[model samples]
Target chain A: MDIQAYISSGILEAYLAGELNEQEMLEVDRVATEYNEVRIELDALRESLLKYAQVESKAPRQEVLDGALKSIQEIEKEKFFEVLDDEPEVRIQRVNIVPVWTIAATILLFLSLGFNYVFYSQFKNTKDQLAALQSDQTSLANRVSETNEQLQYAELRIAHFMSEDNIHIRMDGLDLAPESFANVFWNKKSNAVFISVDNLPEPPHGHQYQLWAIKPGVAPIDAGIFDHNQLVQELKIVRGNVEAFAVTLEKEGGSPIATVDKTFVKGFLKKS
Target chain B: MTPTIESKISHLLAERNKEAIELVFTHYGSLLLNIINRVLRDDEMSEDVLQSVLLKIWQNGHNFDSSKGSLFTWLVRVSKNAAIDKTRTKDYRLSQESKNGVEVVSIAESISTGDEIEKLYAKQLIAQLPGDQKVLINMSFFEGYSHKEICENLGIPLGTVKTRIRTAIKHLRSII
Candidate 1:
């Protein structure tokens, strides 16, 4: 490289003026390092420019520099004091566990209270339900007693007719109506019989059950008429020796005598 | 100042020495103010720029490379740049233009060198350039303006302005 030619190319002036782009500046920096003449030229250029700028230079006030220095010093002092302030307090309070333990206890107490509140509320609800169920049971028992009293009143009404001497015939269901059962309590003196169809279910609609008093030598007699609602009925009893009792379906009201094919229940009583 | 004094200044800046800082205030404070006053020509703003420059030097002295330039050059660059930046702001320029006629003679005289008579004479030789070249050198050196700004301000092409300033410096270098 022609070092003198490089120095005379006006590049040093550009470098001194800070006019060179970064690439050019780097190149100039390299050349200045490699060649002593280039370095001297660059320095001379910078010094000359510095001298020119110094001639036109405007100096600042003393108060400004003083104020800036003072502020920086104050900032440094504040930082030092802050570090000092933090150190002792941190050391003294480092081992204190009271606040941590207090927080833990507070959390535990809250959880315990919450559990107790939930359990107490549930217990209260269960107690209230139990009291309500007890009341319901008492009312149901009272209803059952009332129904029993009504049943006794019906038995008393039937006993009035039954006190007289009458044929007391029991009816056992036959194979055709195996589940059907009835009893005939007859008073021979009053000629009245109370039919308790206790074990018989209600007959189907448009059908009536007829009762008969049967003697082996005679034809069956129409004792009385009964419907489904008449689970127990007071019927006018026939004044005769009844060898056996039988029930059959006739028309809706009943027939003069029982139809033998339609017998749903039958029984016989022994003479006492 | 010797290398020892320079290193001591660097060390004091590193340690953030208050007394050293006060000494800076007592010595170079007025010099910085005078430089800022010429560029900005406003006492208050000059003071502000000087403060900014001193604070910068205090904070960044560890990064200063003496091989690149003298500490004085760095200080001058910082103060000049601060003052120029202040002048570029709308408020400073508007106020400065309005208060343009007020001659800041005392600040200029104080900044005029008596300690380095030969160096001051060398600087004066460069100042004898034509008004346009003089302005270009000031803008480039004192205010840190680019070649582009000098061209725009002086109504010359960028290449021509660069060449002219280079020629001006070459002439100044020969005479000095």
Candidate 2:
């Protein structure tokens, strides 16, 4: 083959462009490998292209190098994990290092140690789990007892409210709060008053709900003050001949007088 | 001196030495970036590809047989192939077409000459080439266009494309 004509055929350039079919590329590879002259010519052509590529060279931003190094290190770490995945195979290949009986003895020893460790771990885990279950049971029992006490108290309140000896009065919301409502349960014999505040806006900070027993042409007697957390509360028992019950917002601790304009709800007593 | 440095890099890379990263990046980073940028036509994407190219070279360093070609040749081949693969992806093609709709044509046209190319790669080596030869070299060598594709793209005969690329290579070798 005429080396000069072959070099001039542009096949080497086509090979470098990676445009040749696989067979043609193999042929070019074979020629370049067999002939020193073709190899030298191919290297020179590659050098020229490299120089051409150098013409457009622009330095990448400075930080890209750091980013690249970080990525490489991370990939290296992942590769290390992948190598670990193949560790058992590598260990198997090293079986010839020791005598067969010695190796078997070592394997048996390891198996015994492994079983001991697993049993100990499971025993300790079961102990811890049992302790946790006992603690949970104790807490749950306490909660159940607390709930039972609350249920008993609720039943007593229902019986008291349903008794014929109590006068039940429904209170309507005042002009200040049209949506507020409460029920007054007044026991006739004991003269005790229990008010169930069902729906009332939260009182202003540093304020409390005050109850009063009202009668005609006299100062409104303070019943009792209660926080909003409880729906039903007992108030100071009225003495006798109470006309109506009213609730007002007053500062913490009881006030001597009701803030009439701040009354949230009021109810009138009717003849039974 | 350059050959000695190249051999040092080749050895370090084969050994998987971290020091090879600095040496390779300092020596050929720009050239590789330029090759990728030529194919990608986006500076940001090109830079990203440049990093992966170095990583590829590092990971496959043992495969680089110096008997076949110089280290520079291998780097160029790897970088060019990576960039070409990126361009062939559906995401890249769709984004290129959707970005400006006409940017695809402009990118192809600007392979030979453009304002950005004028400012960035205005080395006197390629600047001094005759217009036709420069265009052929830009498309064939830098853009990785084969002779047949060059023919179809330029609307010239395939024989003409091959002859011009061969002539351009010869002229470039003589100049260097």
Candidate 3:
């Protein structure tokens, strides 16, 4: 490179004036760094410009420095707060819409989050209320089923007692339970026996009332155990002729043989 | 100032020492104010801009790279740019446009009206340069006008504008 030609090209003056583009500036920087004469010439130009500006120098008032110091203190305070907050400062650029849009988007995001939380709480509450309603509905359905079952049992007992073929025998209470009595309904054709206890004493825990059917000159046969609380209960069938019906206190399941001392009630069927 | 003292001041500025601001005001504040004043041509606004420019230097002092240019060159560039930006404002333009011929004439006449004898002599020294060179220097250096702007404003080719600036700076270098 011709050093003198490069110096006279006027690029250094443009560089000093800061009028060159970045690429041109870098090129000038490279040339000035590589060549000693170029650097000296550039420095001389900068000095001349500095001296030219100095010729017109005028001192500012002391108040200006005071104002500058106050401004610097304010800047330092803002920087300190920025450090404490650990949030980057929002720099607003003139003639640009992006920063305004950024602030809007941030506010919208927070609002969306708040709305999401509210909806989630409402959804959870609604779900819990729905579950509670479903439980109530299920309990109501169970109660209706129980009432239906009781109605069905009452209808069956009424139909049994209204039948003409059923023979009802009254069983008187013995000495073990003098106040207790029971009525037995025996279907003539089917030989099905249903016993309805009027006032039977509550049996001990693990003890229940068992009914027996006795035929002439035959041993008493086990009919079935029944809950004293039951108004009407069906017992085992006696296919042959039944001479008498009796109830005895026994264990949970009926024993094969009836205990004589534990008998609570006994009744003889009218000879038909 | 010695390169040693300049390097020390650069280090202090980079470290953000408060003393560096004081030193900057004492050393280069007037020079920078003059750079700003050339563009503004108003004492109050120029003084205000000079304070702001000082604050800007302190805030961005670490960005100054000595390898690019002298600190004084960088300061001049910063002050000139700030002043130029101020002139681009609507308020400045409106004020300039609304000013009567008398105010404009007074502003022009006030450029040479200073108290110091050396300042008067320096003003004459710049006036002693050839008219074309003087105008190029004033437009390019003091006014912060670009080569392209100078070409468009003066109706000269861009090359001629740059060559004249170079020739003018070389002439000022010899005389000043």
Best candidate according to TM-score? 2
- Model 1: residue A2 alpha-carbon error in angstroms: 3.5
Tens-digit lDDT string for candidate 2 (A70-182): 88899889999899979867777666545687889999999999999999999999999999998899999889988988888788778889889889988889998889889
> What are the clashing pairs of model 3?
none
DockQ-based CAPRI category assigned to the predicted complex of candidate 3: acceptable
Worst ten-residue run, lDDT, model 1 chain B? B106-115
Could you give candidate 2's per-residue lDDT for residues B1-176 as a string of tens digits?
A: 44556789999999987678777787667656756766776777888888888788888888888777667667778887899889888878777777675755765667645665565436776666666676677666555456776787778899877777888889878877
Give the 10-residue window scoring lowest on summed lDDT in candidate 2 chain B: B112-121
Error of 2 at A229 (Å): 99
Tell me the tens digit of each residue's lDDT in model 3 across B1-176.
Answer: 33445577699889987677776676656555655766776667877888888788888889999888666567777887888889998877877777657664653443333433334345765656665665577566655456776787668898788888888888888878
TM-score, B chain alone, candidates in order: 0.52, 0.62, 0.59
Candidates 2 and 3 compared: the better one by TM-score is 2
* Candidate 1 residue lDDT tens string, A176-195: 77887888887766767778
| Per-candidate alpha-carbon RMSD to the true structure | 18.9, 35.4, 16.6
Q: Best DockQ goes to which candidate?
A: 3
Q: What is the lDDT of residue A189 in candidate 3?
A: 74
C-alpha lDDT of all candidate models, in order: 0.67, 0.78, 0.76
Q: Model 3, stretches more than 4 Å misplaced?
A: A56-70, A73-272, B1-6, B18-50, B63-128, B152-155
Tell me chain A's TM-score in each of the predictions: 0.41, 0.51, 0.59
